[model samples]
Target: MANIDPIDARILARLQRRCDEPLEELGQHVGLSRNAVWRRVKALEERGVLVGRVAVVDPDAVGLGLMVFIQVRAGHHSADWLEKFRRAVRAMPEILGVYRMTGDLDYLLRARVADMADYDRLYQRLIARVDMGDVSASFVMEELKEGSALPL
Candidate 1:
């Protein structure tokens, strides 16, 4: 990350909590003028520090309470297989996040499903498109922490 001053850090910290924080309030919090704060915010965006903001929704509220993490091991480590795997996983709306990690597991997929039946349907669709050597799944029983705050 680019080196940010104390004022910039304060701006980001507040923005992270509420991206659309009023300029006057944010300026008062960081001891700067509203226009100055606006300038700095624009500069931060230009530097790519502040990308974009979106609303955070609860999975349970959307009827996707169950969280399942699926680890995929490659059946065939080839270009065509990888491309198909990527496409298959991306097409599933239930699959919220996918990651290619540097460990034993080749890919990790985080899926938000309604229940076991929903997850099974997703699994069947996934396997029908791309092959997996080993697929392991874990259900989250509880969510202890979920936040978008980054350590500043």
Candidate 2:
């Protein structure tokens, strides 16, 4: 990541809150010309600071009311096993986020489903494709906060 100055920080903060905000509005808020603001945005993108804009959708409204986190213990830690695991994850749309972490857990997956049955189906599919030592799932009853913003 590039060193972000005060101006870049302000632009990033504003963009995090609402990526779809008009360039003129962003310029007004950050005390820069629209062209200047656009330049900074483009530069940020080039530097890999600004990833990409995405629409925030309501999961519950779309029948994805259940949120489950699965902790996976890999049976084997090898390049072939890791490749198979990654491919299985990539093919599953229900699996939202996957993290390879330190500590006892080898992998963690955050997934969405309509209900337990849907989640079970996903679980069966995943395990059939990947050799996991153990898989433990936790269903979330409430989510306090969620966003893609960084504390820059």
Query: What lDDT does the true structure give each of the candidates?
Result: 0.93, 0.95
In model 2, the worst 10-residue window by lDDT is 1-10
Query: Which candidate's lDDT is highest?
Result: 2
TM-score between model 1 and native: 0.90
Residue pairs clashing in model 2 are none
Task: Give per-residue lDDT, candidate 2, residue 103.
Answer: 98
Give me the overall lDDT of model 2.
0.95
Models 1 onward score TM values of 0.90, 0.96
Q: Write the per-residue lDDT of candidate 2 for residues 10-79, one digit (tens) a residue.
A: 9999999999999999999999999999999999999998889888889999999999999999989999
Off by over 4 Å in 2: none
Instruction: Give me the displacement of residue 144 in model 2, in angstroms.
Output: 1.2
Off by over 4 Å in 1: none
